[model samples]
Target: MAETKKTSATPTKVAKKEKMLRVTLVKSPIGYCKDQRQTAVALGLNKLNSSNELPDNSAVRGMIFKIKHLVRVEEI
Candidate 1:
């Protein structure tokens, strides 16, 4: 006689979550150039020690890179 193994009929499903970014102004941009300062402002950080939660995308990431020295970033 031969024996066989049984498996479940339903397939496993996996859920995916969208990536997000938390950007905070860690340093003052007063001494920075106009473009850098404007970049920070465009990210919605108008004051020192301010933070904004934004989506993780190329445009936003590019903006962050522009003022990476003036701000802190965390993935959410």
Candidate 2:
């Protein structure tokens, strides 16, 4: 009898799932906290009526919460 060798196959890679949230600046941050202003800046919103799409993560959510009164959020 002859000896035989077995070969293993490579595993397939799966794509990661990403979530998105639409944020819009409705109000001004003139009298808001510094952190709130910073968050707005991070979101790329400097003036009113500006909108941005950000990853729906905990950190972004926290920032939105910090400036909830200064902006509006929608799931997209």
Candidate 3:
């Protein structure tokens, strides 16, 4: 008779920690790219002096970088 071998179960994946960034609209979005305006809107910033807290992910960072002249970002 031959013996059978058993394998261990698959390991569980750990969820990554999500960081946050506080973004504030310091300048107007007038004359800015439509995409920039959209980004600001998505961030809940429609007017100057407005602010929002967003996830500190690549996509959000990219958006902030594009409108760095219009917004201020601080680590939360």
Superposing all C-alpha atoms, what RMSD in Å does each candidate have to the true structure?
6.4, 3.4, 4.0
lDDT of each: 0.94, 0.90, 0.89
Q: What digit string (tens of lDDT, one per residue) describes model 2 on residues 2-68?
A: 9988666876669877889999999998897888899999988998999999999999999899899
Backbone clashes in model 1: 0
Model number with the top TM-score: 2
Candidate 1's TM-score:
0.76
Candidate 2 least-lDDT 10 residues: 6-15
**Residue by residue across 31-61, what tens digits does model 1's lDDT show?**
8799999999999999999999999999999
Q: List where candidate 1 sits over 4 angstroms from the true fold.
A: 1-16
lDDT of 3 by residue, 17-69 (tens): 78999999999989978998998898889988988998998988888888899
Query: What TM-score do all the candidates reach, one by one?
Result: 0.76, 0.78, 0.71
Rank by lDDT, highest first.
1, 2, 3
Evaluated with lDDT, which candidate comes out highest?
1
- Candidate 3 regions with alpha-carbon error over 4 angstroms: 1-17
Assess the local accuracy of residue 51 in candidate 2 as a C-alpha lDDT between 0 and 100: 96
